[model samples]
Target: MKRRKNIKTVIYHGSIWIIGLLMIYPIFWTIASSLKPENEIFRNSASLIPSIFKWENYAQGWQGFGGLSFSTFFLNSGFVTTMVVIGTLFSSALVAFGFARVKFRFRTPLFVCMIITLMLPSQVTLIPQYILFHNLGWVNTYMPLIVPAFIGGTPFFIFLMIQFIRGIPHELDEAAYMDGCSTFGIFWRVILPLTTPALATVAIFSFYWTWDDFMTPLIYLNDTKLYTVALGLQMFSDPSSVSAWGPMFAMSVASILPQLLIFMFFQKYLVEGITAGGVKG
Candidate 1:
């Protein structure tokens, strides 16, 4: 029995390592390729180590085309992503709090409508959204990307927060009310503090989605100077030919750092948040 159990444990650990490596292989390949000379990249694609490391990829990629460097693109992405995180946190928390706590007329109906919207695909409303933004003269600007978030935030975040808040006891609300706490005060002082894990989850998700968003930025932004990292990565490649693989790979590696760092820093919070938001709430 002991031998069989030991064998099973070994198999489980080995399988986990294998799966982890398989998942990380693409990222490893990108970083390895970034260091290789352009000609050597395809030749040694299967290998994780480059025969000759060309350090110019980072320099070339950051130098960028035209007068604007990658600094501008990074700045633009940072700004948009920051605004999106803030907006998603505030708006989603407020909306979620209302659904979770407050009694309102037709609240269930409104929540159902929000759920329906969640099922609706972005592709379905793409054309209408574009037309509306164009009419509003929000084209070639960050307004289209950032403003919608402040208005409502994502349904997923709202729902997650709602579930999280529901897990909080209603007695707290009653107690706060007894202390002459208003609805807003209860939310701000009590509910908000208790929902930290859920909020962290929302912020992390919002950061990733906003940072990796490509199609929306591509559609709205025509100016090269206003491009985000996603758009900037695409800029390294041209359709006509003569694409810079080395530089593209370099930028791709750089683009991953922010997400990797966020996960590393918030690893505990993320796990707690997801677990907390998943089961009870």
Candidate 2:
């Protein structure tokens, strides 16, 4: 019996390791390809080992093109991502508080509308949003990327916060209110502090989404100098000419560092937030 149990454990762990490797192989390939000479990239694509370690790919990629270094792209992404995360946290928390705590007319209908928006595909609204931004003189600028977040543009984040807030005891709010704390005070002083896990989850998600967003930046940013890392990576590829695969892969690896680091550090909070929100109070 013990031998059978050990065999089962071995099979289970072996399957898990194999699947993990299969999933992570692409990332490993990208890192390996980045270190290989351009000629060897596609030639030996299947192999994780490179014949020559061309560390120069990082240097070349960082040099960028059009007189703007990759630093500019990084700075642009950093700024947009920072603003979006801040805006999302602030707006989602405030809006979630209202829906979860406050009693108001038409609140249920409004909440239903917000949930409906969550189900709506973003592609459906893309054209209309573009036209509206263009009409508002937001084209070719970061405004289109950053402003909507301040207004609770991502309904999913609001919904997540609302669920998390609902899990909190109402007695806390009542206690605060009995002490003469206004609604806003109860939210700011009492509720916000307790929702740290959910907030971290939201911040991490917002950062990841905003940083990795390519379509929005591609559509709005025409100027090379104003490009984010996603757009900057595109600049490496020109169909009419030979593409810089090595440098592109190198920068692709670089682009994901922030996300990897954030996940590594705050992954606990992310899991906690997700689980807590999933359970009703």
Candidate 3:
């Protein structure tokens, strides 16, 4: 029995480490490529270690086209991401609170429709959304990327919040009501605080989704000045001819740092939120 248990333990840990390294290898490769000179990249593509580390790739990439610094792109991405995180958290929490706590006619039907919308691919609504934004004069502006967030946010975030809210006992809500809290007051003071872990999860998801979004910004933004980090990365490439391989890898490595740092800092909350939500459901 002891021999069998030891064999199983060794196999389990061995498989886990193998999978872990496999997942992390791409990130390690990108960083390694960023350090290699353009010429050395393909010359030593098979090797993980670089013969000559070109630190200048970062500097060259930062000196962006049309006199605009890469700092401009990072800043633009930051602003839009911040707006999205704020809007998604605020709006989704409110809507989820209503769905979880409030009772009203047609509430089930409305919630069902909202949940059904999640099953539809975003491409299905792209044309209609584009037309609406165009009519509203939101095209060629960040409004197209930022405004929908405040109105409703994503269905996934809303659903997560709803599930989280349901996990909290109804007695706390009743106690708040006895203490003269209104519906909004109960949500603000009672449910929101208890759902801290879940909210953190939502914020992390929102930040990543908004930061890494390339297509929406591409469709809505026209000027080079308003371009984001994702767009900035693309600026290095010209499919018709030569592309800046070294600099693209350097910036790609840099772009990853922010998200890695955010996730590292919030990892505890993220794990707690996901595990708790899973258990509750």
Q: Give the top-scoring candidate (TM-score).
A: 2
Best-to-worst order by lDDT is 2, 1, 3
TM-score for every candidate vs. truth?
0.93, 0.94, 0.92
Compute the lDDT for candidate 1: 0.88
Residues 1-281, model 3: lDDT tens digits: 99999999999999999999889888888888888888878885866788888889889877766788889999999999999999998988999999999997899999999889877899988999999998999888999899888977588888888988987999999999999999989999999999887888989988998999999999888888999999877775555423667877888888878999999899887776566556754
Best candidate (score: lDDT): 2
RMSD of 3: 2.2
Q: Local distance difference test, per candidate?
A: 0.88, 0.90, 0.86
Sort by TM-score, best first: 2, 1, 3
Steric clash pairs (candidate 1): none
Question: Which lDDT tens digits does candidate 1 get at residues 146-173?
Answer: 9989877478789888988998999998
Which window of 10 residues has the lowest lDDT sum in candidate 2? 234-243
